[model samples]
Target: MSKNIVIIGASRGIGKELVQLFANNEGNHIIALSRNVEAMSEFDHLKNVTYKAFDLSSSTVLEDLTQILSEIKSVDILINNAGKLVNKPFLELTKADIESCYQTNAIGVMLSTQVVVPKMLNKGGHIVNISTMGAFQGSVKFPGLSAYSTSKAGLVSFTELFAEEFKETKIKMNCLCLGAVQTEMLEEAFPGFQAPLSAKSMALYIHDFALNGHKYMNGKILPVSLSTP
Candidate 1:
C-alpha cells in the first residue's frame, strides 16, 4: 500500500534526498513543500511526487497551509525539515534574526503540525522534527548558533510535549537532533568545517525512522551523529 508522506523544505539537502528516496519506492506518495517550487523541477518526472510552493515564515502560512491540506485526505508521515540558520555572534544578532529563526524553525513547525494532526486522527501518523545536536543539553555548543540552537531546542521540547499529549492517540512525534551534515546550511554556518555524514546518508536513516519509528519510539529526541558533537 502506498503511504502518504508530506515533507516540508523539500527543495534541497536532506529534504530533497528524502523525496527522491521515498518517490523511488513504488508504495509511497510524496508531497513536497518548499518556498521555491522551481527548485523541485528535478522531481517532476517522478509520478509519486508532488511539489508545492510555500513559505513557512510567511505571516499567512497557516491560511496557505490550510488550503494545501484541504487537497489531501490524509497524511501518514509529516517531516518538518524546514529551518533557518543565522551565523552571527550573539552580541551581533538582531531582533529580526532571532525572530526569523524562531518563526521558521519552531513556530512554523508547530502550526504545520497542528493543521496536519486532524488529518491523521483516524488513520494514525508519525511526525519527525529535524533538529540539531546543539539543542541537546550536554552536547558541544557551537558559536554563532545562538538563535538557531535556541529555536531548535524549543522544537525539541515541543516534540516531547506533543508526543506525550497524544500518547493514547494513534499519532506519534519525535525529534531527530542531527549532527553536522555536508549541506549548504552547514557550510554557511561553519565554513570549512567538514561533517562526517552526507545529506543523503542522513535522509536514508530519517526515511526509515519516519516509516517505522512509531513502532517502538515515541516522545524521544534521538541524536543522529558520528561524533560526540
Candidate 2:
C-alpha cells in the first residue's frame, strides 16, 4: 500500500531526513515543502519525492497551499516539521521576532493542517507536529528561547484541541517535543553543544510514529529526547 506523505520544512535537518527515510521504501509518495527549494535538490533522484517552495511565514500561505495541493487527491500523513528559532534575550526580542516565531511555528502549522485535514477525513490520517522541549511544561527552560519556546508551546496546545474536535472522525493529531538533536538548526541555536541524537536518528523515530502511532494515541504530546531537560 503506497502512502501519500506531506512533510513540512523538508529542506534540511530532521525534516529532510524524514523525507529521505520515507522515500527509501519507494512505496510512499512524498511532498517536501520548505522555503529552500534548492536545498532539497539532493532528492531529485528519488522519483517518489517532490519539492515545493513553501514559506510558512509568508502572508500568502493559504494561497500557496491551495496551488500546491491542487492535484493531490488524498494525504495519508502530514508532518509539521518546519520551525523558526529566534534566540535572543527576553527584552532583546522584538515584536517581529515574536510574530515570526508564532507565525511559522504555530499559526502556519495550524493553517497548513487545516487544508490537509479534508483530504484525510475519509480514510483517516496522522498529523505529527514537531515541537521543542523548550515548549514542554516542566522541562528546563532556556533563557534566549523565549520567542521560539513560547510559540512552540502553542503547537502543543493545538494538538490537544484539534484532537478533541476531531475525536469522532478518523484524523488523529499529536505533537512531539524534542530535546537537543545534531542538525544545522541545533548548531545555529547552540554554537558548541553536542547533541546525542543525529537528525537521521531522531527522524527514524518520527517516521515510525507518523506511520503507526495514530493506532495507539491521539492528541498526545510525547517527548522524544536522549537526555533529560
Candidate 3:
C-alpha cells in the first residue's frame, strides 16, 4: 500500500533527497518543509509532493502544523532530517550558537515527532532521525562541534526512549548517525574538504532504509561514514 510520509527540513541536503525519492514513488505521498520553500518548489511538479515553509524552532508554528496534520489524517513515515551544525572551537562558540543547534537538531525532532506520531498509532510507521557519527565517538579537536555532537547524542537517546514507548505497537524508531555527506552544509563547514558520500547516494540509502529499515532496526543508531572500512 502507498504510505503517507513527511520529511522535516526538506529544502536541501538529505531531506531534499528523501522528498524526491519518496514522492517519485507512485505509492507514497510526501510533505516537505523548510524555511525557504522556493528552493523546493521545483518539486511541486511531482504529483505526490507538497511543499511548506516552516521553522521547527517556534512552538506556535508547530501548533499550526498540528491542525494541518489532523486534516491529512495520518502518516506512515516520519523523517526528522532538519538540523544545524556549528563547527567552531568550543571556547569560540556563543550561547546563541549552542541554543540554535539544540533547538533545531534536538528539540525540533522531539517536538515534530510528538505532532506526527499519533497519526501512525493504529497503522504503525517508521521514524528516522538524521543524526551524526560524532555523537558516538569524540572528535579530534574539530572544535565548535560540541553543540552539534551533543544535540545528536540527545537525538540518539530520544530514539531509544521513543522506541521503548511504542514497544506494544508496530511503530518503529531509529537514528541515522551520518558521517560526512556532500551537502551544502558540509561544503560550507569544511570549505575545501571533499565528502565521500553524495546527497543522491545518501538519499537512496535512506529511502531503502526507511522502507526495510524498520524490519531489522529499532532504537539503534545506524552509522554511515566514509571513514568506516
Of the pair 1 and 2, which is ahead by lDDT? 2
Per residue, candidate 2 scores C-alpha lDDT tens digits across 112-203 of 99889999988999999999999899998888999999999999999999999999999999999999999999899889999999999999
Model 1 segments more than 4 A misplaced: none
lDDT of 1 by residue, 101-160 (tens): 999999999999988999999999999999999898899997899999999999999998
Please state the error at residue 93 of candidate 3 in Å.
Answer: 1.4
Error of 2 at 102 (Å): 0.5
TM-score of each: 0.98, 0.99, 0.95
Residue 124 CA error for candidate 1 (Å)?
0.4
RMSD of each: 0.9, 0.7, 1.5
Worst 10 residues of 2 by lDDT: 220-229
lDDT of 2 at 2: 87
Per-residue lDDT tens digits for candidate 3, residues 70-174, read 668888999889888888888888999999899989987788888888899989899999888887655333556898889888999999999998889989999
lDDT of 3 at 95: 92
Model 2 residue runs over 4 Å out of place are none
Candidate 3 stretches greater than 4 Å from native: 138-141
